[model samples]
Target: MAGETAPLGPARVCRLPPPGGAEERVTELCTALLSGFQRYEQRIRARQYMDGLLRTQGRKSIANIATTLGAPGDEHRLRHFVSRSHWAVETVRQALTAFLEESGPASAWVALPVSIPKGGEHTVGVSRHLSPDRSRVVNGQRALGVWYASERVVAPVSWRLELSDDPPTAGRSTGGGPAQEGVPAPQDCLRELLDDVRRWGTPGPPVLMDGRGEDESGRLAALFAGQVPAAARINGWTPLAGGHRTVHGRQAVAALDALSPTLRTHRRGRDGSPDRRPVATATATVRLAGTGNRSRQENRRLTLLGVWHEARREPGELWLTNMDESAADSLLSSARLLHAVGDGWRTRGAAVGLRDYEGRSLHGWHRHMTLASGAYVMSAISSSSDQARSSGRSP
Candidate 1:
């Protein structure tokens, strides 16, 4: 059936919170979006158009947000804000501080991972080799995000997105057919992400992330390699890498040629049969191939810092973690918290993976990133609630 043509609809009038309330909600939502998840800009903008002009587009677009917010009655200015915005990061930070007022005063252990989406050729932060796909020709800016997981939490503590660039390639170009080189590395973007997290400063549990260059056994490791109880995914050998094991939502499987010599007991099935002992936990770093002079020995000091408490693996995905079954499994068994942070943008507002819906041109495409780390942070809160409710711990 062919779709019918429609005229400009009447201005939407949504059930928006009053002025003070609206601001508060906006701040609250934005803060949760920023500190709690990556893709703050997309989220913040989506919230803004929940009521008015944007609503006319659909429930998923910025226009929908305007309708949700009761149209704000300021079409001209509001439209402009929605079209071009970049204040999401700062706004989210402000909201977090305001929220921490009550949740503060407790030790907080944090874990964050920055995911680099693989696609595109002319992306500002695109690089070669760092991508798992091994696409000599990369696409889009490299995405490095941070996920925060509090000590007492099981789900994500929060999320952050960092668009980073890498050294340029010599034999790769569009029109010229693979013959361009001499750009720069994306070390700056990595530096900025670290600096931002440090400024956020936590007085509680030590901060943690996957083994980053700065995360050595030093005083400034964002994620302390020494303690605070953490279970991370590992690569090649790191001693802590064990046979297929899982920690709550985190799963660690074997990697191609990255498996280590470690034995572990696993549950093959419901029957109490002991699955052949898999390797023990292991962790190590590798200098991923890039288009630069950063040699393997110079930047690659792979080591097993500590044992991870979870096995972070995806289905049919190979993963290695520096964790033993006894240690990593223990944390996984006790886990019961989870949350997520994601951001998506579409020129035509269609679902990201879909073939076509609406874009000015035929080849229009949208980019959406959903980061999942600190999945433990949210699960922890859920566990606590269920336990409290079940045990009649209510006040």
Candidate 2:
């Protein structure tokens, strides 16, 4: 299969072991996983998760897993491990970290819809009594838009933003108390995502995300040094000067109010322009309804309402992140990757990857899954590499 041809993404199917030594591919996958070990803790978690999943549940367990990487006959073991609430949380965190490390260095744009279920009464890590699945309350399930970027390589990068928490159980409700704010704080989530990529031990490309990353509009002020940066629909708003509706920034209030309605859901590459189409955006300038003031407000609340016309593909669906404004092509590339990864998820029987199975209470299922999945991705890469090499061509 070394010299044979194969496409990329879903259209491409990798061959089996090549006639050449399989050592090189194994080395590459291992090295890749190791290089990002510290940056992406999921690698470690995945290995462990797999170990537990592949273990003989009853009595064939090893003395101390930490002491043995992969025990003898472990491959034949098969009694899946479960995850606890805390372990599930950490496992999700680790998976996100790994995603950043593996693709952040080479990607200039990435976006994913993150679900931040309001902790009214059913949140696991919070003291709320809310359950989105209850069907009694209106406007349930809040999601913080997410984005990741690194302007370094050309690999197709994607982010699968999924919720790690459990849904509200029957006959339970969480309507009182403060909402359990999303991870890393609303304002810092975006920057924090970038920080995770930074730990990859490699210089990353320019990263861009949605408003969730830069929660308050004021955060956008600290761009790549004065270049009013736009990341597709990261902030979920178009371009406004004095911040958007009720946003606490320095744009315009009228500029902000007019945002929601005027925002375009989608736009084509050649938007009726002679030379590669004019960059048209779903823009508006208005005063937010809630906030009365709209002048040179210092940290005044405004709304960041924007639907990037540039990266809009599916009609009625808004591109809610910075990618819409910044990396149009990269956004497209990521969308495609997401579609391919979707298949893998169904095949593997889970929406989130490199995660452990969650059981009630405080089980350590997540660590086990992360360990297994991390090892799995590595193994898959190696397998593909071997198949390519076997066909007589370098992968």
Candidate 3:
């Protein structure tokens, strides 16, 4: 097996000694989990990069990884493997989806966000835009990504880079090549990404979003109608409940602000003590915007839950969701999910070089994100399995 002719040019392969403990587990993971890459050479290259990403302390750029692995000569080869290769990223994503179905938590929320920070404009999709937090303006790649959260797990499953309006004009010039065609607007991109999940036969969960816009017209409600329920943070000024109750005519935040003070209805505080802050909840059916080609507004009955803290002097939090009257329960779950997603982002960036890519091509971005996501899930599953083993139980 050491000298077999392989798909990648004329490189000779060597078999490693049989493993015993951690090495064996990692080797098995590299082989079994990444089986979607059919070609042996592709698998080898992928594992190599993943290993480097896992082992290197910081900045998992191709050159850094190549140097760390003492294979400086393979830098160009690995770069080509990521940017110019024809490997199917979709297959790996499908495998991820399947794996989640087998050992994952019950679907709670599908939180999607549409931006990642970048330093320069040369890379594909890099443009000037408001940050996702909307705290300031920044230059970055516009990306639409889907993250799934259950009781115990949160991980990114799909991503699309929003191509800038001014894609590189020239063909394969020195800089990062031209941007790929067929990039959709951010809203449309979310639908496309969700459609991919549908194609995988995955069931829909509540679409949780923050900071889309004033949902007075309920455009998002119409968009996700009949597919899955949705939860979002609407602009404070959006109308609700036909102007009847306190929550009807006033801005969403103001309505919640005027409610009588009550203790928080959700879980205990981070320190395991009961929260004493005032909270409020309400429900209403708002009108949604048109769907497809129709210009007419559609009616979508939704629930609104709000919590106000006297110390804050404003509505501390608000939610608009189409879940049952128990929208408060879903809000609690979705809030935990939102927190988990933030933690996962930090972990991915630290453990697997989520933001360390130096490649500039469209394919490169997708390939990097796919591998990074796989690495993240693999680490999570492996850790979970080890814990179960220590406890003498099956995972």
Give the Å error, residue 345, model 1.
Answer: 15
Worst 10 residues of 1 by lDDT: 1-10
Q: TM-score of the candidate numbered 2?
A: 0.43
Q: Answer with 2 or 3, whichever has the higher lDDT.
A: 3
Question: What ranking emerges by lDDT with the best candidate at the front?
Answer: 3, 2, 1
Ranking by TM-score: 3, 2, 1
Which window of 10 residues has the lowest lDDT sum in candidate 3? Answer: 1-10
lDDT of 2: 0.33
| Per-residue lDDT of candidate 2, residues 19-135 (tens digit) | 333455445444444443443444444345434433323221232332344454432222222222122333344344454355333444332323323323332232222232232
lDDT of 3: 0.58
Would you estimate the TM-scores of all the predictions? Answer: 0.39, 0.43, 0.75
lDDT of 3 by residue, 154-269 (tens): 66777777666665622332323223445456666666666666665356566666534322243454344554767765544444543334233235434433432322344333
Residue 196 of model 1 has an lDDT of 46
lDDT score at residue 131, model 2, on the 0-100 scale: 30
